[model samples]
Target: MSMMKTILAAVAGAATALALAAAPAQAAPTAPHVRGTSTVPAYSYENAIRESVWVQTTLDGDLDGVPDKVAVDLVRPRETAAAHQRVPVVMEASPYYACCGRGNEGELKEYDANGTIAKEPLFYDNYFVPRGYAFVAVDLPGTNRSTGCEDVGGRNEVLGAKAVVDWLNGRARATYADGSAAVATRWTNGKVGMIGKSWDGSIANGVAATGVEGLETIVPIAGISSWYDYTRFNGVIRSPGYATFLSEYVSSRPEACTANLAELATGSGDDTGDLNAFWAERNYRPKASRVKASVFVVHGVNDTNVTTSQFAHWWSALRTPKKIWLAQQGHVDPFDFRRAAWVETLHRWFDFYLQGLRNGIDRAPQASVETAPGTWVDQRTWPAAGTRPVRVGLGNGDGVTGTLGGSSGNAKRTWTDNPDLFEAEATATPNTPVPGRVAFLSAPLRRDLRLSGIPTATLKVKVDRPTTELTARLVDYGTAARVNYQGPEEGITTLGTESCWGSSTAADDACYLDTAEDVVTDDHAVLTRGWQDAAHHVSLRFRTPLTPGRWYTIDVPLQATDQIVRTGHVLGLILQQSDNEYSTPSTMGATLSLDLAGSSLTLPVASGSLPPAGATAPQVKTAPAPATSSLRRPDLRQLP
Candidate 1:
């Protein structure tokens, strides 16, 4: 370990010197568009892709008594040349209603205070378009030079999407990416698809509810499914990370950059504010009834801003054919890859649905990621076949056990919610603080446990006070202390009592501003761009997995780990109560309890016996006296 550290330091020093030497040389400028790329032509009609700015007007559907405006950048393939060709369209609805007013110059501002615009960093230009598709990024009503009040979750945005589709279907283009002449209106293959990262992801789901005529597919990444649970997790009002972004952060930008800021600032906080549902209707997945588009959802498993559980609800409820991609990276991190590998998968997914392409993408597993434990597992369905829900009891100070079907009696555990974990900050790395939670271990595995899909916990828990925060993380105990990738974490909290957005110019410059008077810092401030939410006393299921050899622990007596916990390397069941520097801002001071007898970790026990202690995938099991709820099986269950 010492030698490895020394080598790493030397390597870092050399890299720094090399960067300094090359700093003076000016690099050629890249294209100025979201997802702009340098290697390919900005617009390519030959491969069925082009880029152009578009404009449209908003309608008063609910007869809100006032009209609105909207505008978008439209990118797609040539029309006349490709008839009956259905292609997917990726669209980004502005984060704030005021976002679309002025355009961001794709600036890279300072990390902390250096002075870079906090715009969503572009990965490559029209990269997805040339991959054979169309893309649309639009400003919401009353924002970014667009017209209308900031009717946030209300119907205006969805209506705006329908208007854009209508405009696209009727228009005729003058040329293609190949420099060939053509009519803009001829490009209508009569199919539309939507994809976006972060807030745009939320609007993706919102507009999908409209059931627009040409709409076909939606890909929402790292966006919340519920507004209530999103801003407030586990009954505690958390720092409005996403809200701070639009209300305060984007609101402060120059008007020419994002037009709606002025209007967003103009609205009344009590009711007229477009940021809440009072103005715009909230968009959610149609009641498993009105949904029309096939959906493909993605969320970062380790995302600090948007927890993994946000996508789980939609995945379970959506009526259309849907597939979910759970990446282990951060929000929008998947776009970091310049190559089309990851982007191609997205294209193929849309191709299968929109174009009826007989690609294998549809047959791919319901879940997949590149760096996980094993190759993808293809199942006829998700939540797997014939699996029953198991309830496990949590024990005091990291002791975990419970019964799946057998009549295991009741058990309980106690824990202290240490507020100090709220102090230690986290960085994206192999080693960092895994906070607030506790861990329990099972003896060496006897057989390969292939637990794919979601796992959850149900605990009759009690906090030290009336309000508390609880986060459940399930991990597979791996060989050499490697924890297999579990799905996203489920954050639960009480509602209404949670935080609300507040901002003031007199406040610190670093605070994200929602308005001159009310700012939504990592503290209070909320928005309903439209996602799902969770109420209290809910037994939540996580949609990720736990691999073999790793320990699985559920943190019920949840606390906050603000500081880093660097213990010796051992596979761990990381429990976190609060979102510290590494997470969304959370308040402190709370105690929690878990009824251990009611909570348990479920594993897909393959047919085999438990293996020896040091062996990677143990192939053996032994029947020991059932003293505690936590059990170690020595023999694998035989296949039916």
Candidate 2:
């Protein structure tokens, strides 16, 4: 079984016990323990209680400090023979909570004082002991059972992690459910690795940056590197999302939670727009530059919750040897099928980096899945440059196809910006299903058009309305054969970001990107209505590759409107008007110039198919078109 499955089961077992103990009167059960010399009093809890966990020092962690009561659970192994084996160590920090939120000083209490592990499902019996990895989940200083005050952006969390590493490497002993040595000091090899989703992922990155002795590898899933991108995207607040998240946790912590919900409810932690020292401290950019350990970066493309931009920031900034895996799904994709691949990939990485095992990780694929393709792409570097940047334009006309070089070819297409429909709120309308937005398409490839590059869309737009915004997306169309864009659609649903389920087959009614609601939170800070930067053109970019024999579509929708009804999926330069947050902007007085010639999306086209030897060019052939009619740029008005 994979380490992930084992860990999941272990955590589940612990959680189940906690769930059974929710009754008000019963004493929570004490975790089994192995007799060992303790620098501090043995941590005790009511044994008859249905669920309970406590922290007691097995060894003095800090010489200058008194033995601290550290929150922990001892999960024994299944056999004495297993106890002798050098088990791996998995260390993690919990999310920022009331007592645990950065800078708050409070003991790590049972989540909700329920004492049930189920409530904290991330850590259960299904997760660690069975995998032969000792799982140590710490509440950063000043939270739950641990001493010290919370320092949200402080070094205490990383320092505490290092201290635990030292203690675990020594003569510490842990007892499993069956009273076996799940972790004995003898089993430690002075090696440790960290794994966490979201906040835990951030902690892992922070600890790795410390270059703590014995630390080996890290798998950060959907973790943030730049606080700027998380709380604000492109300098705009994703609003209630980031603000709500902050408020929820701050309320949990009594010290920092000092503010009334009303106070906390006021979104925007700070009002400054510039990058200052305070924000810098909270940002992980500096730490990313210092990471030396091998890292496995996993994130979802359509994740508006944390925003994929943060991942992109870290992936671009990290100085360490790293491999990034895009799940083409949502934030929780790592917990699904990706988990199996992650376990295999991570084991090889750790073995190669930490254990000196030649598991061929050095030769493993660098860029993994691109949503629709559903397969891993092995490359020496990311954004593998080379695929030529292609540009095409948008034109008007009927349902019938219009030839590219027709005598009646028009240079520009115009749409009205109705003032009645356009407003600051227009941007939100497109987040859901809008009638349509402007789209641009390239001529069908004469030769197999191989692309793997960054895409950019720019529109020379003039709006009569002062407040409005635009959203653009690049989509791949299956022309010659079957293709699936629903990979993203279904992936997000699995991650619990949306309620929509998509069909695997290409059915117009069943398969479509979810535009029914604006998943992009205000905190995400994408372009917003009333805040359109006239000097700076609005565009959307993400690292995604398109396959051959497929027609890719780019959707640029104007959002926030109050007039006109729009519906259905329409192909071509289509424009629909609506009041949805994700819909197209309403027309007040607007003249838009979609400068297709100037805007280009570059893709890395591989030379010889058999893995690129360094950086060589792919063989190219300008084959004739397949007796096909010329491709035409669709109009904007006739869209869904």
Candidate 3:
């Protein structure tokens, strides 16, 4: 039997003796204990009572000399306070307590009249709290109950969270609003696991990167590790209003972080999209080598808000123990797709790592990859260990037929790079006669082709201007119906009815309104997209402007993904200048002169076989690709 089974079997007898945290007064069982340490019962759930307090951090974000206090709401097994049992902690430090909300319900933290948090968002407390873990919902400094200025992922933001882990380990101080000592985390064993989604999850990454003691593990779902990559891609401004808007959104008042906001504006380098000390300070990926805790990462393959590369590059750099889940949804919570299974796996993970239960989670597969909306398979390693790079050439006079080993000498096509055109508009059809786009399609596939890992396009090209914004999209084009993984909506449908998880109380509930899965008829799906600044082709930090009419060979790495193109499907590569959703449109246009002799797209193929010599491949049905219908620009591009 595995170590997990051995440990679980060894403690099976005591599991029945453990009492439920939320049980009525008539309950007679005691809390579960193992090896002199507290452990959650495998059969029963919810042995904890809800509580609240304010914790002081070392950083005075507002420069007020007195450090700011973050609100911490707790729920843990009540029996721990009765005896020597001390439980582990699961923390989610968030800046979205007042705005945006958490999970599918958009549930905000509700506050009592006295300013203490009356209820927290999500089912973390409802589920895990009952499972012998203390759940801490912290309001980040400068947001909600926490006092200070919002730093927007600056030094203050990272330091503020680190202070919490210090306090939990008995290295820092915490007090109440009345200047009295707050209740200690006396019930905890000082081992903590942090988890959250998006910005909340980013904090978890930042704190874990500090190598802070007591942070045993972290689960960062759809989180950003490098803020620069969040707003800029390869020195091109991918999105605007990231710094100023996010800081303002979390602050209760505009003036609360006015100076801080100004500092973000000047330092973000939005105008130039260059790397500086400002972006370096906000970078969590660079500190990944310093991370000490085990990490469990979850991200959607089709996520556009934070993007997939953010997770891909970070996962590649992590040296410590790690696991990943790549889902098929777009910017969504994993629970919405696979709630029960996710909860069960998470339970086993925390139980093993933090509680030292030895559930054999470490022996489980390191990665889970989605093959479809409702289908997934375990992988021995993320990005699937090894794959050969196959070079597919852009051939045919018009370069519309995507083929491999067919070198068309000096086959050049020119398109005026129109800044106003959207990517969806550029990739409207396989033979789209767009004025501002050039597209290439491979011959109808002879057999099923599985593409995994990052795709790169090495182009021998020249431009009429000194600099230009470039975009490459590896698209799947065919008549076969598939998941609508195109931007900007990513094919999600909101629903009317709501679903609830765990148990509900008068103050806090896990119930949330539901959103129906988005399953749309799709002719072609944008598989992976990449952006670049022509000037930054040589180096991201240094700009090397191209001479007009100069041939410059540049390799653009497309977004990383795992997708299967069924037999009879054709692969397409679309070259365009701008995407309104991904970045601000350039004011000027440029002419791209392509030289196909030395230019080809390199793809990492995980599986598929080449056709026999002279064998006629089957014809693939073609449909007019959806431009306005599917790949329309999103409202998020137009930041308010």
Candidate 4:
């Protein structure tokens, strides 16, 4: 009887153990939560996973025998691995991470003792990682720890970035620092969105133009669409050896990239300022048709560095889902201009594109333009709806002041190229004669005139020099407060006080200095300017040197613009030679003659017509020079 009772107890104990083993293991913590249109922070940011990998590319940009390896630093929610959940990626592939730095405060990446990333430069990881997203910071080949030579915007740079997207989608290979395979297939959902400013943003533009898979969207702020446009404007070189200089500036080992630098200098075609196969390879506009990802473009109307033409040409070519924000500032990020709103909008954009959120962001207004200082208006399309080109002829008068619209005979005006004269001086005293430049003014507007889109200047001119540089400027003559884009602080002044954007840690903080628009009152502001070389007047691909005193007709397409000319303000066109700020100076004392009857300024007028030529002209005022400070310029080059 005792043995039988013991057997029953043993059987019961075995049955209880089997029942416990059969029960399911506790479920891992749930992924991030979604409230309305945004991904809420349901995971701990401080405890997020941080690691680095080297992605192999199919390029030997440094002339090495093997393919190059691009360094990728990443921060992701720990829940992704803990719960075995996959997340999308938000990436910024940049050359500025270890050199010029990034954002308004010039933050650089910081790494911990374990050779992994400890802190990223921007608020991306701090804000998005906790929301169940992975933030990847990739160093372009030849920059930082990446193994290759910087090729500017060549195949090396563009393909290197695309390889990261390929790796995220399990199409390319990546490895840890110790050479062990590092696979993202287990953690990634295969969706990627790229975002950055300046050169970093330019890479995003290039990568998206490749039509790479898994790239869902891109936010390119002041990105260059064409390398030719960045280095040259209408067949005129902006800076000689600029490509080589930039490559060396961002390279981790400049000595190893000597051949690459030489190739860039030669391929840039600065000597001829003509588009070639080299520049063609770097031009992304022609490849826009291949882009499958949506694009969110942010550009400063007053950004003289990258200029408005970069975004203008690229935006016009895109047929994919797209949106734009034309800011009033210079070369600056939207975060510094409109922090709270930018963050919220960017959050929605990422949530929609990356997380597959069915939020209505894709259905939102297609364009948001800063019509005036601190004023932004949403529109269904850019160019402000009813925009059409209106051709207004230039009437002959004194070499200084002429009528902008009216029947004009064969009167001619002449101005000599003065390399020493700056645009400020050339555009000043419009009603009075200015040496080295000729000006034509329209009667004060009866109502506010909104000029949208690009303006083209058709000029019949004669130049004595074989190759003379021509400059055309659309100027607004009035006294009003406008964004100080040309001032030392490029439209925003950084304050001492700081504001935090997300959760923080000892190594990485979300806090940054506050900024405000830097506004200044000026009598005249140069709205848009275009530069061209007479030698390449016919085509940007070739040059046709002019015969001495020979007549030629050229179309100078001014930079894209959207500006409102207030009533009582005069609209003026200044024709000159050698824009000292943007182009190489023409031969000193090269005389230029303009046939006024044959010349006209074609404007994309969105509202109001120009006053009759016989109407009264507004009195011109001479305002003091705009204020200047010692603030750093946003252009990669340092101020004098």
Candidate 5:
């Protein structure tokens, strides 16, 4: 009996050991953790999985029978390949991937022999992939490997990018190049964040406005909120056929997009420069109420390419959790200007929203503004905390130089339009007489006057011609070192030394050249500028030509700004005609007569008050003004 019991025990013990060995090993934790306010690299960057897919959309932008397919290149931790771990996505849908390129270096996407992404432009993928997030670089429809016609910011462009987000959430379909279905259900957690600069960033703003279910957040840097505002200003065409031109510039196969390009030209309304259904469809600001994702807006105060109004309008309309960074640069990325801090802040933001980490970033200050060259300050909100509109009357003095003060003066000043004049020439010598423009100078400021928001110029005037162009500029007159935004490099000069942001591969290195702020000492700087057509003063949709010699009230909304007019500096407003750099010249040579008592400039002042009139303006010795260069819009065909 004892021998029988021992045999049974041995047999049962062997069976139990076999069952334990057959079971799968426990899965390792793939979620990253915060170590001292930063996400630890819990995953391997060098061994991350890389692949590509073609996401199908509902649009036939190229007039093809089948729907368009957007090319999506992906990089994620190896743990996500076998359905073992799921991660959030960081996506950038861009047209510049194969054409104009991206960032200050204009780095284009490079692929390996296997048609997989070997080198991704910028540092987003390198820095975020190891942090346990999947980075997706999508080629906009009609660009690169995507099959469709580029539509600029139209339905095809917006929806094509949105489909990738849908695929990750299992709401749409995608496939590999060999005709196999590419399903993301095994790898994604259904949470995504869109980020990019310029045209790429504009797509992000558009996608976020759609309120897509899986989208958690967006970071739009120097992005356009409204296509109409981007190419036109108050019924003035900044560039004729800009929509068509840009579409052709970025399209990989421009010949196939002829129909679409023609449609863009006709719908843009360049003849009248009026807002219509074409622009309405592309405008994202009106759809802000539908945005479910948190927004992190970054823009340059002196960005002439996209302009500051793009951010200002979008920022005011968003009702979701938001933050902003107002840089003192122009048409440049924050990564190049504020690299270290930008990477850290962006990491915290992604961790908080995508990783669901309680990092307290949501509880921090909402705004980071560059108050001076290379100087940044944090604020509770944009436009500062105590910003209030103050109206300063335009006083008629010598027709050449007028007085800007608190009390209105019943005087008339007149100036003729100069179609050939540039802004630098028109705004020079504010206290002295100048032809083809009228200047209004405020008494030297007693204290630092900080302008934190958009300014508006309301003028009651009579014009000699039925239609003409009008330009207004708010100038700060003081010798100081300021960000040279107007320079060719746009406030940054790349150095020879390189800095790495993350791990690297043989094909793609995680390094780039360093940069320094480009500052110039000048006597004065144009803080903000606005342009309009006298005929369309009544409305942007319709034009009612002005009746010669009849007084009409028109409001010109200037670009948004954040600047400090230091003590002893003079604030001047210059009114001119036909800024050839920004608008097509009217060349009508129309004379404009202003009614001083009815004209005023309303400014959103954050601190200090305008000094009383008759305070003698000081004549400071001026350094030779920084070399003024003709405004050259960045060439999308060859950005670098």
Candidate 6:
């Protein structure tokens, strides 16, 4: 690849260059409060200009022996570029530059007749640009105006986006289309913060993992930290062709990226669904440990798309300063659910971290979690720091009733892996069992209990076949009003009129169509779900085939959650062989024998006074799988 070994002289802005030449090296300026508060009244939105810059990357993404280009669309207060005052930056790098769009209404970046982008989706640019912050929207490599191939979340994705932070901090270069050097981003301060949802948010996580200088913080909402986890669950293919499918959706000219797309397909390990070096290179957890930036994670607990564990695992690995927002919605944005509160919290977050202002953000609550419909609480830490994991064993009962005990004698129950069984059907009847599935219930709790961490199902079972997959769900069985945050959009309807977070502009208006209220209804809600391939019990990278009659004990981690089961509501641990919501059914159809003595669901239940000595957790009869509760959830993978 051709390297533009230019002197750093040009990379530094005229203002910074002149200062360096005129004076000896001095200490950098102290962190200052650029804006008084995060309130909208602190600044105006109309004086910002929408612009674009093409940054150069070190990776030859197109394999053309030339570094690729990253298109950076920026919106900043006009005076900032004029050298009136310095402002920190906020960026969102995305693969969905034009295809399918972003957010619920699917808004794409609109361009004027002259080729300059006119409007951007969501309100980041519209609202934050005027609030003493520069909002940058970047088109990831191989997409939109960027030149090269899409590597999904591989090294290319990390380096290409990392180059932007380097450029802002005067460590990288950029050029215009005609090969002329572009203007250095010298007007504003070099601090940069990244944020986005889904793929866009994943970019933030990837870049932050690089520990790149100038990347001060990241706000990854419903983002993926491990590409392998995104498509596979413990060695079983949760969704085949996910990389290829997403590649097709984000890019229009597939022919140009054919080689890159081919690599993704080949490296996915569709045949065995095993993790290899390819996936190891894409995992951000290891990289995140070295991060120099702070983190602000927002995710939906019921999100099956990226899943809740994606956020929890990543959050747990991060040693940097961090914050979290655990919503009750599935693959949904908090903007639609919390609105004004989200903006205020995010504004304060940016002000404190990026602008280096003491806005009480760090001193404020570390988590704002939604427990149920319209119910939320703040805490000092996610999962409240001292959560105790309790193992409630499978107890005595008719195969259909849930009898959870501390140590029930060994009992056997059998069910074949039924992939077609609907989640609604599994929790529908209170005393019946659905075909191909078995339900274990718990007696109504005398006192309310809360779950605040990952729930693991330890199952001792014998498989009749070489390999099989099991799906475990920690569900609430009582009829209570809960948020219908099952699928995309989180049951919020799009409205007619536009609501402006700030004053509007004719071309780039600060207003967007408001969202309707959440659909809160009285029904059974699936708190969280987890899946595991029986063959991958020992390791996700290797398969250990099950011996016909030999029993194996496996721990399958269920999706993490932060909700409380109200008093009188029974908790159900439903076990199934297949889940149509994420993957296809396997035909081996081996029966699984559950040895209750060794099987128990380990849950991070809230601490409270025990019921009493000798009081077993109790048992309850279960409803048959809802023959058609599919209506309750929208299509999986449907973007919000």
> lDDT per model, in order?
0.42, 0.41, 0.75, 0.87, 0.86, 0.77
- The alpha-carbon lDDT assigned to residue 521 of candidate 4 equals 91
lDDT of 4 at 86: 91
- Output the number of the lDDT-best candidate: 4
lDDT of 4 by residue, 498-557 (tens): 998887989999999999999999888999999888888888899898998889998998
lDDT of 3 at 273: 69
Please list the residue runs of candidate 5 whose C-alpha ends up more than 4 Å from where it truly belongs after superposition. Answer: 1-38, 406-408, 615-640
After superposition of all CA atoms, the RMSD between model 6 and the true structure is: 8.5
Model 6 gets an lDDT of 0.77
Give one digit per residue, the lDDT tens place, for model 2 in 1-640. 6999999999999898888776467654322221121111121111111222333343332222554334443332334223354545665665443334321012232332434321222322223344344445666554554554334433544555556665566634333334444333555566677777676677677777766667778887877665544553333333433433443443224453333333323323434233445455557666666676778888765454555556665677777678877654544535443444554566466556644555577776676744232445556665453434434333322212211211223334335433333222222222222222433322323333333433333344433333233344433222211111123443433233322111111111111122211122121111112222231222311112223222223333222111100111111222322322322232224433333322332222432111111111111112232221332322221100
Model 6 residue 603 distance off true place after TM-score fit, in angstroms: 0.6
- Model 2 alpha-carbon miss at residue 274, Å: 4.6
- Rank candidates, lDDT, best first: 4, 5, 6, 3, 1, 2
TM-score for each of the candidates: 0.57, 0.55, 0.88, 0.93, 0.92, 0.90
Better of 1 and 6 by TM-score: 6
RMSD to truth, every model:
21.6, 18.6, 8.7, 7.3, 6.2, 8.5
What does candidate 3's lDDT look like per residue over 1-640, in tens digits?
6999989976874665554534566844454544233344432223356556667777777766787777777777676667756788899998887877887667888866775555778888776765677788887888877788767677777777787788788877777657677545676788999999888788888998899999999999988888777777777876576788778877875666677788888988776667788988888888999899999999888777788887888888899889999887777777776677787888788888887877688989999988766679998987776767887776643354334335566678777877657755666655646677777766667888877788998888899988787789987777554555553445455567777666556778767666545666667778888888888899877678889999998888877888877787777788887666677643348888878777888988888843421111223344644555465555553211
Predicted candidate 5 versus true structure: per-residue lDDT over 1-640, tens digit per residue: 9999999999999999999999998975544434655667766777888889999999899896889999999999885565477888999999999988888788999988889888888888888888778999999999999998878788888999999999999999999889899989788898999999988889999999889999999999999899888988888888776888888878997877888888998999888888899999899999999999999999999998889999999999999999999999998999889999999999999999998888899999999999898899999999899999999988654544677774445678888876756677766776665577888888888999999999999988898888888889999988889999989889998999999998888877889999999999888999999988888888888889888989998898999999999998889898987777677744468998888898899999999988886633334334332244654433322221
Candidate 6 is scored at a TM of 0.90
lDDT of 1 by residue, 81-155 (tens): 354444445556664433232111222211123211122223222344544455566665545535553344445
Runs off by more than 4 Å, candidate 6: 1-47, 585-587, 609-640
